[model samples]
Target chain A: MTSALSAEGLHTYYGKSHILHGVSLEVAEGRITALLGRNGAGKTTTLRSLMGLTQAREGKITIFGEDTTRWPTFRIAAHGVGYVPEGRRIFANLSVEENLKVPLERGGPWTIERIYKLFPRLAERKQNRGRQLSGGEQEMLSIARALLLNPRLLILDEPSQGLAPLIVREVFRIVQQMKAEGISVLLVEQNARMSLEIADDAYVLDDGAVVYSGTARELAADDARVRALAGASAEEWTLT
Target chain B: MMTQLLLFNVTNGLIIGAFYVLMALGLSLILNLSNVINFAHGGFLVIGGYIAYTITPYIGFWGALLLAPPLTAIIGLAVERVLIRPLYGRDPLYSLLLTFGLAFMIEDGTRFIWGPQGKPVTIPAFLAQPLSNDLFFITGYRLFMVVVVMIAVALLFLLLRYTRLGVRIRAGTLDLETVAALGINVGMLRSLNFAVGIFLAGLSGVLAAGQLGLEPTMGTGLLMPSFIAIIVGGIGSLPGTLIGGLLIGVASGVTAVFFPAASEAVIYVMMAVILLTRPRGLFGEEGMMS
Candidate 1:
């Protein structure tokens, strides 16, 4: 299958100390690719580097067969990539509707009306400021905002972080729904079990380098390796 | 007789308050989106007055009034691109110092170009007249300035509320990184925002020139009050600046009638009281700029 995005030999740094050391990964077209790592394993940094939010000292990032290594964040976004950063960085001062309107309206199947229909909770709180929304609702709004960009590849950084188990399940369902709609997804999550269940392909990152790269089913089946590589969160597989 | 005097002072205060609002709103806009305290804002005002003064001989007051602000905005756009653009994402102190230095350069530059002597912007003869003998202080030009400020303010609000650029600006002010991730050219947005702020400054200059007359040092005197207006209203809030400007104007104006020496000091006192009580200005959001 053709890849939606591929990053090779990514060497990223924050000031002097190195964060990502030759980290490389790929997202298959119309499939969810899970990148699982423990705390401080550089999952978010990898996402940031691919999106050009932080430049990689040495790497090549190609999206849909085009080089995007040197592109700026907005240019990368404009080229049909939607990113929902960690912490659900909602514009607290803006209303729900205004937050949705912040993304440049790329022509696509997703529109504000469709977003409201998909997330009725957001429609109910249309006039409410983003800060007023609960964590679950903020995640929904962040996802809805990215969807409005009508991206070919949607990169979500820790959508399930700081969320209730029920909300986490709901977010996973939405990821599955996006894949069903033919959009490729690159999911970075600490909850390995939930991510592995929904993901088709998987890469386990340990200490800023890929420790294991294989099919999601293969990684999920091996409990010993999943625990060894993804750390303690792999045990969360039994809870959900 | 006493009530009539009070009424007159209140009216006078409101007119001055309107001028403060125009100037302060521009400063607030630039501060909100760009986080740049454009000390050169008053310098732009001086430029506007001088441009109007220089061109009035050929274009007339009405034409200069129509042309000056946008022309000043174009110059502001260039300054933003060339000088201010590099300092963005750096320490806020750098931009502040740069603009502070720029203010001095502008003052000296204008003095060199226009001479240090005051120059008057000739108003139409009809505008200089009062409506009646009893209200001799209410000249038609002052009334016209109020109307023009109101219209400009209304348009600014409409632009921020209805347009796509407006939505992006308000959103960027809250969270710029997210806005950039969503494919908005935040740099372009900021440049446009800076221009809008400078446009307001230029308009203030043109209006002030007609009333107070023009000198290279004129902008410096007006700059302090505009800064106070922002602090009194709250940073990052446009409506608050408007109210702050008017409140200070009225407070000072009424004080001028009762105690002439205390007129200017009253605004500072009001600011102190608001800070002690609310701590966020009248309309500032909690935890903002904390």
Candidate 2:
């Protein structure tokens, strides 16, 4: 499979506090790649680096077969990378429709109508400002907005961060829907079990370095390794 | 006589208030979007008035009115690109100080170009004439200024509401990072936003040249009231700035009748009361646009 995005030896830092240490991974075209780690495991940082929101002091990031490590956030985004940053970051002052209108640059297969069809709840609150939406609705709006970009690679950072498990399941369903539509996804999640279940390839990150990179199913069956890396209960790795 | 005095002062206050609204709205736009207090906003106003004056002799008042604002906006965009763009990620203090220095330079430059004496901009013969005998305080031009301001403000609000660029601006004002992530060029947004703000400043200068006459310090005189208007109206709310400008205009106008010396001082008193009672101004949204 062709790689949609690949980062080689990415060394990222936040003002001298080194966050990502030579971390390298590949997200294949049309497949979900999960980066799972503990809270301080640099999951969000890696996603941020790829988005060029923060620069990697040392490394190369190539997206859709082009070098994007030196590009700015807007340029990277313009190059068909859609990022849903952590915390939703919705423009609270803008109405739902207006938030949808915020991105001047548009892509295919994701018109406003198409997005509304995907999340009917967002359609109902079209006139409502972003702040009016509940957590689940906000997540849907974020995903819907990214879909409008019709991105080559969708980078989602903690889509299930602060939600009830039911809503999380719904968010994952949306993720599955994206995969069905044939778009590649680079997902950073703390919800290891759920991410691992949907992801084709997985990387277990510990202290800013990739401790394990292999097929998600293989990692799922290795209960001892899952516990060792993620500190999750070993039972989570067992196949239901 | 008292009723007549009341009518005159109230009308006078509103006209002054209109002037403040024009200036504050422009300044507010730049401050909210760029997080930079353009200390040179008044200087831009002076430049606008002077530019109109320079060209009025060549193209006449009608032509100057049409031409001056776009010219000012272009100058503003150029200034923003050359000077302000570098300081965006730095401390706001840098932009503030740079604009502050630019204010002095602009003042000196205008003085050097136009001379220190006040210069009168020629209004059309009909506009220079009073509307009627009953309300001589209301000039054709004063009413004209109010009407022009109303149209501009209305158009500005409409632009923010309807257009694609305007939607991006409103979104940028709230959360620029997300707008950028969505692939909108935020630097270009700031430049356009700055130009729009300066356009208003320029428009006000053209209007003011007719009423107060053009002088280097005229912009400086109006700048304080605009700042006060923004504070009293609520820092981030454009409508609040509108209301605040009008309120203070009428307040000062009314006060002139009772205590002639306290007219300018009354606006500060009103500002103090609002701050004490409601620190956010009338329409200010708490925890919004921080």
- Leading candidate by lDDT: 1
TM-score (second chain) of model 1: 0.97
lDDT of 2 by residue, B82-190 (tens): 9999999889999999999999999999999989999998898898787788777778998999999999999988888778788888888888888888888899999
When superposed on Cα atoms, how far off is each prediction in RMSD? 2.2, 2.1
lDDT of 1 by residue, B1-290 (tens): 77778878998899889988999999988989888998999999999999999999999999999899999999999999999999999888999999999999999999999998999889999999997898878899989999999999999988887687888988888888888899998899999999999999999999999999999988888888888898998887888899999999999999999998999999989999999998888888732221
User: Which residues of candidate 2, in runs, are more than 4 Å off?
Assistant: A228-240, B286-290
Candidate 2 lDDT, A61-156, residue by residue in tens: 999989999988888888888889899998888789988987755658889998898899999999998999999999989988887887888999
- The per-model lDDT (C-alpha) reads 0.91, 0.88
lDDT of 1 by residue, A106-183 (tens): 899999999999999999999998899999999999999999999999999999888888888888889899999999
Chain B global fold similarity (TM-score) for predicted model 2 against the true chain B: 0.97
Show model 1 residue runs off by greater than 4 Å. A228-231, A234-240, B286-290
